[model samples]
Target: MAEKGDFKHEHMADEANDNDTVDFSNNISARIKNPLAGIRQDVLLRDVEEFAAMYDLSDITPLLKKGALVAQNPADFENVEGLDDTERDVLRDEVVHKWRQPRALYTTVILCSVGAAVQGWDQTGSNGANLSFPVAFGIGDTDPTSPNYTRDLWLVGLINAAPYIASAFIGCWLSDPLNNYFGRRGTIFFSAIFCLLSVIGSACTQNWWELFICRLLLGIGMGSKASTVPIYAAENVPALIRGGLVMSWQMWTAFGIFLGTCANLAVYNTGAISWRLQLGSAFIPAVPLVIGIYFCPESPRWLMKKGRYSQAYKSLLRLRNHPIQAARDLYYVHAQLLIEHKIIGQTNYAQRILELFTIPRVRRATLASFTVMIAQQMCGINIIAFYSSSVFQQAGATVLHSLLASFGFGLVNFVFAFPAVWTIDTFGRRALLLFTFPNMAWTLLAAGLCFLIPKDSSAHLACVALFIYMFAAFYSPGEGPVPFTYSAEVFPLSHREVGMAWAVATCLFWASVLSITWPRMVAAMTPTGAFGFYCALNLIAFTMIFFWVPETKQRTLEELDYVFAVPTGKHMKYHMTKSAPFFFKRYIAMNKNATLEPLYRFDNVQSDAVRSASVTAYNQEHRKSETTKKLNL
Candidate 1:
């Protein structure tokens, strides 16, 4: 009764429906497919109307309708009706002049920078203090022959590692509850209090144990602040330049490292109390962070999550340049959140933690975040960050010269980080990691080998410092910026705080391990062996990163759910089959025309239907070819 053509059309439509069902079942494939795509205009309008009514935004219902349309398909915003020229120009400026943001946004980023400075200064205060604190506390053991020598080494390491141990085990985990109840600004304020008190307490401590206890308390602040600041920056920033902005965390951390070294040098002349001054001076950064956090707006995403949509709108209004831009982002983020909630579902705290591993999409993000965070520790930057003065002393420099050399390393680190702000968004996260890791590997190896130079030779310290500075130079632009920025953006809103806690925990745990072990490791293996071990680790980190971590640059925090939804095995196989060969041919083999297809498809609403039709047609053609081959055979 049905004609052949009609039968074929029905069959194709049936196949498309089957495909859609399969995609929906996995949730992964459906997530990768844009939620905005193929959404009917009438349905979107109706949803917008309902959303406005539910949220008590009836006064802006007309604006909300237009905003929803623009949010659904941002690429077509220019053609979106009802947008005045001012609204249109603001959207255009978002793309063309990405950095031209509201002063409040820049202020928020700067405040976050100050928070990072507290973290860095906190870290390196112990670095300068490492020189004198052990002596003051009666734990100094420069003599290898002393009975207490081994015990002192462990004690000093334990003291240095105390903060990180606390951060990894206790402080990072607190971020979830702190952020949940206090909000970003509130959590940051709370952390700054701990940082302020701990630094002053460390300065006033009469003994090593007292100092250790103070540093342990410092970790509470460090972990929570570190976890929140990058997420705050990421949520506030536009995705087009998100990487550049969020990475300010590391850049300013580097600046704080530089300042710490300056404080070390500045107080070198202050007798008896110089180390105390060195440790307490870190409190200065915390002071600004505590006072200035109140000046910044709370993260709008966090506000939205609390069911305070009106407050979120008000917050976004301050962060974005114009009301329409604010409205668009608010509605867009809300739409994405609706879809995200449906897919992720609701869960208790424990269940959310479990879902991080149980959910396919979230599992990929967890693995990636773990990779980057651990890789940061594996790169061995913190070894230099925590003990560069001591390292310089071991390299045959005088105490003053060692402090100066440490200052040089700090200066190089801070200066080199400037490039990443420009490169991170444009050149991309994964590519920077790939490019810098090998360079870091060799430079670190070279620095380690430089330690083998005879102490009497003029070139010994020079070569050591040169290679160490070079290692820092390579590290500052790549690994330094990528970890926090990458980890901050990967998780969905539901898991963001916990996911970041997990990530920061991994980082600090390894940092604790490194700090605790490096003293003994260097004592047993010597500097060459110690540095060589981390150099090998750098390569290992590189391999893990190439296979596991996805490029997150330029994607919205909401959009990244789709990116991570891609199954891990398939992503790795594509890299092996396609990206590897293309890299080999294009860069290594010097081929000009080698092409590699992208792994993820970024399609707008119309392309979703087009892609479905194309897939169906292709399947039909492939079946015909197969049948002809079978008949011919």
Candidate 2:
């Protein structure tokens, strides 16, 4: 009997060994076949209750503790390496995918559309108001050489600069904190309220100062949108489709500018209805945006990162069609935070912005983003946008003619920006920046010379107009979207909002200075001199892009850190994977698509800790099984 029992025990031991061998073989084989596959393998949803329970006792315990995934154990803890492989995998999965789907991309589009429309309305509203302001304010007819003309132009310049200046400082303050505090939808709601107040104030303004104040108030909302919209999009989308989604906002912004131009033309032609209707019409676009954003899902990341994992999971399920996918994504996000040693509550507002500049890698990214934003502003694009009508009028076009020309410029901007939206992922940042700068500089220089030439000659006027068209077309791809996209990309996931705010604030600062100064500069230098100055500034920017700007076209946010934050040796040759016929190897490098996947979904199962609270869910499911058993009985 003893011998028989020993034999049976040995047989059981052998079976256990065989099972272990099978599992190990499968795991090893999977790793061998695809090395990078495991990076995102955790994105697949599994049984959350089982995973959480298993992970609580395993290697991932340390990480769960670090990510605040598991509450701080009162007991002393072991290191992450101490956990066994399966437990570690569970913990890793917990960190990567969220339990919820992202807010619908369509929802994001609608929310951000308000911000973009605000940008357009402000740009065009001010443009239109500036066009008619001299007459509206009773300053007198605009003659470029007249002192009255210059003063009146400066007042118009103030109106254009007001929103930008206010947005620069105020936008930063409102965007990151409000996003954290109120959540994305709430922040957008407040922005809508601010915008509403701004519009109402503007409509009722009796004087220039009041109008300026109203514009300033409106700008706070606009600035908030500018900073938050892209951040919201980046946080909500998956890594696969990020570029297209973010740039779509830029596309709509350009579209808004186009619409604004059209509005300006209609108002200008209508006589007395001009400035009032033009400024008032600014409120139209944002109304839909506000309504859309109100109904959109919250950012799951913001919630999860804040230790509200259940809420994050629910948000994710709403964003994605597949519940498992959403859970998987949440796990990945947590995993990344664990690897980086980032804890959400540990970081406050100031710390977030400070962290962006304090880290070496982050500092490099800051510099790159800062330089790029500054370059975008100094490239003379806003100069044209803010003062295009004034510029055309000075070059000898009639007021009505200049308004038409401005509309034409907006049309060009709207048309050409579409290619940028499509190709930003395919062609890349380096290629676009490389080609755009020289084209704009040369064009601006030529246009400057045209202004310097005798104004009486139609040839000079034709040349100036031709260059303006070229400038707008070339600008469509780079300046219009790059500043916005780069700001979203440069910072780490945690620091995105504040870091973006800082960068955008800087842009607004420079924009304010430029918008305010350009009119006076034009008055002092004449159109020829102002254009020449811009041409020279752009030439310097061209040099910077060639030497400094890294190609970030399709890189994941993490991958982008390597290019921007990591330092390369001066003479080291940068090799990029070029997927091609091997012909364009020198000019083309491997650029990844900057697409982000959706981050919100519904029905994603969270941790067992949270799942236990969901008795209604299980009860509902068990009801059918119970009914079947009772019938059988």
Candidate 3:
């Protein structure tokens, strides 16, 4: 019986092998006559070849046994360069044309924008609460005879900072792994529950400790919001416009800041109920995130990594408007993951945190993350957001005048963020950061100098307001957006969430330190000196971005991994040039010699540099022909 069973299995295997050979032969012959047919045919087969070549999978039996046809011996990885400029432009145009159909990309931008709106609400809730809490609680100088006025101030700062301390670090840590296990919707749903609880807890607190606990829990919700929402936004948008759309999230954040600041003034007019009302207003937007995230799609990239191919295909279709071949898009996402999994295996929390420094590209990325986060916090963005009114009053503006000016500051923040959002894709990440740093540094220096002017002088106060506007205008576009965008994009898929969590944690960590320190700094050194210190920090940030920051704009997440994952000099030489001169020079010469050589096509392995260049050029030539055909000129 055993012998007969073995004979039967062998016979079946032979039959299957025969069938596969016939099909593959038919596909090759069919594609030989049809270039467009070959364009889509055997894409996965190409990927397998590319993967085998790039990763040296000839020795790996399972990959071979799993139906991948072996090709030439794998090439040295260093020998692989990106597609030359001509090819890149062609492929880029092809991708753009594909992305322009029914506007699934636009829908993705909108859904992710909604999530950002929630983030705005979360950050701004405390902004208003910061101001009115003291007034509403009736903690005052009359009590200085009983308790030091300074102590009350310290307590206010503590209470104000408590949520960021409690929430920021922990939420960032949890966002990615949870998203992996539960999907984007599930993580967002859980986060919204935290938001709801915090909101209810905020409205019902009976004493300072109760309020503190409530704020602490609210911080947890806010932390979740801070970490997960931006990830969703980045993952949803197409890479071409990713910077612009993702930066829009920060724009909404600024809008929220502005709204919250304005709300403080509106609610302050409510007499005894001011702070309670201010704290509770956050619930309005918080309700929508809980309800809305349910309707949002899971990140298609995340779905592909888990081999949930059908779901990934559908999600990609939804995001790209069901382009000519939606499933074809997964090839790129999957190929990138295969390379990433080579380094990180899969998402393990402890392993990821460690790998952030261990992997060379990841280490550069982690540094980028840390620098951007540090720059943002040290730039005094929070001071503007949380305590602008206070700064204005200390600089000798009337309370009414200062609060009103803060409202205008919020408006300017939103207005200026539009240009940042618009230009992030066009100007690129490095350009925006490079351009904004000088303006921000100079503005801070000028604002600090405003403090040197006589307190009673109206002209000095006018200069102070100009400084405020300058600070918001410069910051809203660049420093504010770069940190969030860079942290989310730089890490590979396997470790992105964890990396982001740690990055956000760093920001929160420093933010807590700064938030706690700012009041004391102001108490000790006055507003001018404090602003001067921030000016100096901006100078440091300027140098960091100039020297170390790579432009992530217009690059796919996979391309980013390719760029920074290698040693610095090597990565830059290939990635920095828009048109890789080496590839173009090599290919121009190689094409003359190898015109008769079979063109290589592998799906899993990236196209060989020359062949990839040809494919890119082929697409571009086709586009030019198509455009000419369209115009009938």
Candidate 4:
């Protein structure tokens, strides 16, 4: 795809806009490709204001004088440009095969996904402990007649959400600086070591506050990996399978939830998992991740950002099929870096952090990323997962049945989440969110209403469990993985790490906020009000995604940068605040007067025209061979 599209644009540049040979800095040959060559002049004039509003005024000079794309290996470029139909098919197959290698995409997915599992362990393990811990630790005043017995709503909420609080404040922001200094592997290592300590502390605590303090420690480590893992995994794989690989982060999360529940099941009557063993079981995944993360390779793209071109090439070489293929992928990285050098000179950490909010497109990207993550937390899935056993007991099940039903729910969560691994890239992130949010809202409301029935009615209990499972079914693919996947891919490589870290911070903060409040909300108004609140959140999520989020399917990570297209910092506020966005248009042209018709033809406005149709088409085409077909396209 890179060869087919970039070559055509390069050919069009040479044929239509002949430029005089000019020497440029950084050994780049200067040539302004009139990317608008074949468009109608009237249409260009019609959308003149749109073009100017879309990009910054300050970027016009550099856009016009933009240097030509450079190749790391020129001969490999020739091979792609000269390929016949059969040769193209063979090459595509080879690319697919190489990407599927255990060491390449699969290994990256497994190691980074432990981040998700760590989250699941804390949540589900705690949920299982909730079954008996209140009584065991004298949490909520089992005997009103006894001395020192009081219902502490505020204390319970605080203890329940302690981990999320620590995660939001510490782990979330910590990833960016840790990533900057120690790189992705070091940050992940930091996360694992801390996660292990939190688990040990949680297991040994005798009182609720002790457990709360332990959870706080857990949040610190968990937050560290929350933002770092998905983008790290995404960076290592080809864009072809990027969604599937990144979604693995959530897949392992579901597995961890299941593991936590199973541990609960094993010790349910044995008197272990209630407070100690269930929390300690997080060590199962954390131990392996800590030992193995150091063995994983550093991101080639991160390497390029540091001016370590040789190491970047070597990393890509080990990941890709051949040195030529690695060089071709690395070429795009270098080309993007070279262009940025002309516009944004060496930026310190402080400057990059400032750019996250002040830069129009970066700000836009931040909002887009932040909104989905907030939606993910507020979507009510995790609430259902952490509170399912409690809800089961509320629905009139015995203690044993509630535990059994909770285990079943955990298994269902693990089973249902796999569909996303195949569908996310094909259906697109926004499409999935749009489809699932409505389903989640109604199901949650209906489940809450189920409580209106008699406690002894089997039908009511069954309906509640069914609603919870169906909600998970929708949520597993919807808000669950999409936030992590979408946030990882949207931001430019320049501030991608910082941007994603901020998104994760938003999630952690909200996760804590919601977790703390759910208990009090239920205690005050019953499950009905909590469910009603979740439904409202889902509706808002639908609206935000329908408008703000763009479909990022079938595009390379570098190509995705074009989606935002906001220029430099000088005129960013005007572009961001004052204008209606042209987000769907391809950002191939940067010239002041360039027409965008060639880049985004009339039929190609994805965010607007084809958004709904994508869900239907993607559903019909979801088979084992779907990946190969999409890549072959």
lDDT of each: 0.84, 0.63, 0.63, 0.67
Candidate 1, lDDT over the whole model: 0.84
Query: Across residues 1-633, which tens digit of lDDT does each residue of candidate 2 receive?
Result: 111011111222232233322121112211111111122212212222333443332333333333222221101112322345454333333323322234475566545755686676667667767766657666644677776787776776677788888889796578988887787778777777777668767866777778889989987987787777777777776544566567777788788788888888776767765777777777877777667676687887677556566567668777754444454455545443432332222467878777776765566667667777888887898877777887788788888878888888888988998787656766766567767888898888888888876878987667888899899899888767776776777676666778878887888889888988887798688777888898888889876665555556544454343344335322012322221223243335433433322211111122222333344335655998899999999
Predicted candidate 4 versus true structure: per-residue lDDT over 1-633, tens digit per residue = 121012112332232223312121111221221223333434323333222232222233122111111121211322333334443333344433424454655776687797678788667777877777666677666344655443554566577688788877888788878987888888999998988888888888888888888888888888888878888888887766788788898899988888888887787776644668877778788888988887788988777666565566668767765543464465445444443443345566778878888765577678789889999887887676676777788788887788788888788888988988878877878778888999999988888888887877779888888888888888887777789888998887777778887888898788778777776677667887788888898999887776677667655675455455533231233334432243323233333543322122121121221233343335545763687788899
Q: Between candidates 2 and 4, which one is better according to lDDT?
A: 4
TM-score of 1: 0.91
Candidate 1 lDDT, tens digit per residue, 1-633?
211111111222232233333232243343444455466678667777767776667788888888777766766776778999888777666665678899999889987778788678767778988899899989998899999999998999999889889989988889988998899999889888999999899999998889999999999989998888899999999887889989999988998999999999999989889999999999988888888898999898888777677778889999998888778778777766665665676677789889889888889999999999999999999999999988999999998999999999999999999999999998999999999999999999999999999999999999999999999999999999999999999999989999999999999999999998888899999999999999999999999999999888777787787788788887788788999999999999999999988787675532332334345446767999999999999
lDDT of 3 by residue, 1-633 (tens): 111011111222232233322122112211111011112224434544544343334343233322222111111122223324443343344444534533555654455455455445444555556555665565534243566667766776777677678767567667866777887678777877776777666766666667777777766766666676677778877666678777766876777777766776787677666667667666665566677666666887777656565566567667654332243345445544543454356546787788888877678788878888888887777887777777787778766677787787888888888887667877878778877888888898898888889977777878988998999899888888878887888887777777788788888778777767777688788788888888888888877765567667766676566446444553344333522343355576554433231211232232232344455557769999999999996
Runs in model 2 deviating more than 4 A are 1-103, 138-154, 342-345, 558-565, 568-633
Regions of model 4 farther than 4 Å from truth: 1-90, 94-99, 142-151, 566-633
Instruction: Give me candidate 2's TM-score against the actual structure.
Output: 0.74
**Per-candidate count of clashing residue pairs (backbone under 3 Å):** 0, 56, 13, 0
Ordering by lDDT: 1, 4, 2, 3
TM-scores of the models, in the given order? 0.91, 0.74, 0.76, 0.77
Please identify which of the two predictions, 3 or 4, would achieve the higher lDDT against the true structure.
Answer: 4
Which one wins by TM-score: 1 or 2?
A: 1
In model 3, which runs have C-alpha deviations exceeding 4 angstroms? 1-104, 118-125, 138-147, 569-633
Itemize residue pairs with steric clashes in candidate 1. none
Model 1: residues >4 Å from true position, as ranges?
1-32, 605-633
